[model samples]
Target chain A: MEQYEKIYLYKRIVKAKLFIDDHYAENIDLGNICDQANFSRFHFIRLFKSIYGSTPNNYLIKTRMEKAKILLAKGHSVLETSIMVGFDSPTSFAGMFKRIAGQTPSSFQKKQHAQKNAMQLNPLLFVPNCFAENNGWTK
Target chain B: MITKITHTCIYVLDQNSAYDFYVNKLGFKVHTDAPMGEGARWLTVTPPEQPELEITLFLVAEGGMFDEETVQIMTTLIKKGTFGAAVFTCKDLLATYEELKSKGVVFKKPPTKEFYGYEALFLDDSGNWFSLAQINS
Candidate 1:
């Protein structure tokens, strides 16, 4: 492809991505996303996958999974996190989460909680000793 | 006290093309070019008139905040011209447009009278578009 053509295609793909990022919590479909990019559904899917290596539907699921992970880590209930991530059912959410994350939401949350507690117990572990010394800490 | 934005990202399809477009066509200065681990480079450039702010030429790839799936989505969006990266100001929009065009920069729209001022639209090497405007003083 020519450089200009490549640039133009990349820009269209970016539009679809921005739409997904902004509306992942809502019920977003491939047609609406393609509309945002001003590309037909067939061409959009083909080009999107060729450029980024994933289909639009897969991309949406991945984005939702990422957001769900954040909410789960923050101590949200499984049902709430699933709903917030736009999943219609907790069972489906759990299934997807396990497939992508390799653990159930509850297990992920427990691991996050343990990690949080560890960080809190040894805050210095996260902060450099030089930072404390520069701020006037003796030890 | 609040200061200025030190860094901003402009996602591009290719870093080499972006480098040529921004540095050669736009006449911007390279601020930083360093390795960012994981086969990514931290590339940033600054406009000639605005040295404090750095325009990071971030490549849209499958790393950092993106996974295999998310990277595909972002790459497609960028290629479609979905990202209007930023608005640039120039002392003379007409002269700047001409100069940039002479250096092989492609402008979607030439400098024309907009409601706010005279402006033009141009695409960077990575599919991110920007508005080159001379706001009315």
Candidate 2:
């Protein structure tokens, strides 16, 4: 391929990716994403997979799952997190979360909560032993 | 008070490839190349015009600030072109684009007139894209 043509192809793929990034929460479809890149649906799917090593739909799911992990870690409820991340239903969300995160949403949140609680209980973990000793700690 | 930004990072897949891309292709001057322990090196470069700011070509690996899971996620994200880290400005957009293209740099967008100015998008060796723009004066 010519240099300019290659650049053009790369740019179209970049555009499709940017569209996915910006509008993942919306109900995006293959046709819409292909339109952003100005490529036919069939051609876009093959081109995207060739470049990114994943289908566009899989990329979107990954994006949503990443966002859902952040939200769940921040203490969002499963239903709310599901809706916020564009999952159609909480059941599907929990299943997909387990598949990707190796646990359910609630389980992940519990782990994060336990870590937070442990950190809170051991406030001295934030302070250096030398500083504690200088400040008049015996042991 | 925070005065000026000194250093920023662009995560790359490999340091040697990044070195060739940034130094040999982009024509950036190497600011520091020192051992940083644990098989890592502190590699930084500065643009030709912007010597004050150093861009660290940080390698994405399973180590400091990145656990194994985080490294996996970052690797996937980087390969998918999820990061658009920074914008670089050149004196002449078309000339710079041509120059970089000749050096085997892969640009995603050629110099085109945008609403803001003349801009182009290019990918580094690691798939992180950057906007090369010359703002309207």
Candidate 3:
């Protein structure tokens, strides 16, 4: 009985997380997330952190940042990537990206483009810049 | 010396659900999905990066190796989470844990540092749990 209820709660929490993942591009907030799990904000935050190792808000930002990184790597403009990742303004997105990703979106995008060209130049080598550095393929 | 092992078996209550959980959710690749004799499905999935090893998803029905009584016992045990099937490793345990948790995988334990390494326990669709680990390199 107790175990069955526990599994049910877990399923609800997972559903909420998946909701955030699928709707990260939309204008969703913590209330929308907690509603999916049928829990109040405080309880949801505790359970979510316990299960996922990060609070729901933090998880949402991480997801958004991850998506922004992908968009920027694909040569999207910083403003465009910010909007696509659900940031209200490019300036705020730039600030948050720097805090979370440790570099401005524009600088990261530039680095990615350079890395792409470098990889193409060494077509046969076929390794990421970090991997190449670790392997001493680059000095 | 023995070269390498090719296959491992995990007894699942339902092959269809296992297929969904392993292939769809966990992102494993289906190596084989042919039907076996007597309504049994011979499904096997390989981890995305490790294509050489096939994990066989065996159905725990009252056919082939299992009789009716055995099937009943097995079903009870599996639902009760009696099996610790295997330990699966990843490059980053915490990231993988979060990813899998979001994919609806029910975790029995969160990631923790143990004497061997950092590991978390998660249940499959059929209640079979596995230890997900990230060993120090």
* Candidate 3 local lDDT, B14-99, one digit each (tens): 99899899976886877655443346455678886798888988788764467899999999999999999998887667657767
lDDT of 1 by residue, B65-123 (tens): 56789789989899888889899988656556655675677898988888888999998
Q: Which segments of candidate 3 are over 4 A away from where they belong? A: A127-139, B1-137
Error of 1 at B17 (Å): 1.3
TM-score of chain A of 3: 0.88
Candidate order by DockQ, highest to lowest? 3, 2, 1
> Compared with the true structure, what per-residue lDDT tens digits does model 1 show for residues A17-133?
667867998988998899987898899998777655689899899889978977887799999999999989999999999999899999999998886676545444433345334
lDDT of each: 0.78, 0.79, 0.81
Angstrom error at residue B19, model 1: 0.9
Return the DockQ of model 3. 0.04
| lDDT at residue B84 of model 1 (Cα atoms) | 94
lDDT tens per residue, model 2, B1-137: 98988878899999999999998778687765645445766677999668888898878887555689988999999989999989998755765676577667889898998997899999999999999998886
- Scoring only the A-chain of each prediction against the true A-chain gives TM-scores of 0.86, 0.82, 0.88
Docking class for model 1 is incorrect
TM-score, every prediction: 0.49, 0.50, 0.53
iRMSD, all candidates = 16.1, 15.8, 17.3
**Which 10 consecutive positions of candidate 2 chain B have the poorest summed lDDT?**
B32-41
lDDT of 3: 0.81
Per-residue lDDT of candidate 2, residues A1-139 (tens digit): 6967867777677678767877987888888899998998889999888766689999898878877876876789999999998878899989998998799899999987775565445534433344335333224
